[model samples]
Target chain A: MEANSSPLHRGPLIAAGILLGAGLGGFVDGIVLHQILQWHNMLSGKLPPNNLIDAKVNMYWDGVFHAAVWVMTALGLRLLWAVGHRRDVPWSGRTFFGSLLIGWGLFNVIEGIIDHEILGLHHVYEYTIRHLPADLAFLGFGLLLLLAGWALVRAGRTDTTPAAASH
Target chain B: MLKLLATLALLLAATTAQACAVCRPRVEAAIHAPDYTDTLLLLLLPVALLVGGVLLLFFSPTLFSWKPTPPRSTVAP
Candidate 1:
């Protein structure tokens, strides 16, 4: 087959999109769940923030968590800049956005399982005694995003448009 | 001129940035905990897993393609 007929390489683009999505997902959890709602903290499961000192301690740890996610976001942007320079990767918005969704879903699923279920580090809603429902809901939402993203990405495979660098 | 002076003053006051006098004791005590390492690792686990998987994905996309619906132009010129 001719080079023109070969499949377009999309790994770099997909990877960049996923990294960005996961980083954004982390921010959402940190901001909405941890700060705005006052639901839980990084070590709330292990050390409940019941008092002023303990709450301040948890806040400090939360800052650490935020710093890590910021790094992830920065890395994703750098990768995207590199991917734009390549000629092989197709420029499909569907593929990129789908990848973002997949990344977010993966973050939610992995974090929910490890942090909320196995390790008991924290819960989705720690204010209540029953945390199972909230945890399951989080996982379920992740699964839904994963499936939807997979479908979009699969559809994007048929697009023949090349990236700007190739043009 | 005022902003510059204020910034310099703030930099000089870095030593007192830990916490207010009231919470200084608690903050100082918490800062020296041995369990911080454990907590740090536990917290970073998920991010590590995701980052590793994404890096791998960058190299693996060339291995396969959807044969049923190939791209219209396939290779970019």
Candidate 2:
């Protein structure tokens, strides 16, 4: 029998998964890029590196960008939890984790494209660009992420819809 | 848990130190300096709230409603 699902069960869980994936991934980008590698700053976060303008302007915007990402991450997780259904929430464990992977991949792709290519802000690695390989590789990583997210999303949808699966 | 806590503490320390030098200029134009993280952090709360509110409005009713249909009562003659 095809059981009906509610928004509480579907929407928030999915949204939260997506948001958490994005936020955590973004944070990792910040932590890794800024601290571990020392290629950027915490203020820079995931935004484009400051080379187009003076250092001061770059510093201001970089900090703003980092704060923005941090806020988004925190809120995103809360929203995910708040929006998910109590009874029908996807806790098959497998599906939840799979979605997380997909979501993380999706975040990487979207951020990579918008921040790196479209904005001409920065690359995945610093001081090693100006070549086709680096640019193409960056874009490729994003594409892969989107595809992975799409697959996981589809999987989650299918798992939830048992009746649909039968047909 | 300890690792996570320690990492978070480190991150907080780093963020604070990094932000101190640059957050003022972004908040005030008159300062003639760069400081955006502080204002950005200040703004983060409202934005996160708004996003959370939207998510709640969208999904709370469907996801959180725990009312169960009551069993029909049987009458004995």
Q: Which number leads on lDDT?
A: 1
Model 1 residue B8 CA deviation (Å) reads 27
lDDT tens digits by residue: candidate 2, A52-121: 2334444554456567667667776665554343445544333455555655565555555555555445
Candidate 1: list runs displaced more than 4 Å.
A1-3, A165-167, B1-20, B61-77
Candidate 1 clashes between residue pairs 3 or more apart in a chain or in different chains? none
Q: Residue by residue across B1-77, what tens digits does model 1's lDDT show?
A: 99999999988977864556678688658845898888899889999998998888887855434323443564456
Question: What is the CAPRI rating of model 2's predicted complex?
Answer: incorrect
TM-scores for all candidates: the values are 0.83, 0.54
lDDT of 2 at B37: 49
**Candidate 2 regions with alpha-carbon error over 4 angstroms:** A1-9, A40-60, A126-132, A158-167, B1-77
Best by DockQ: 1
- Kindly give the number of clashing pairs for every candidate: 0, 17
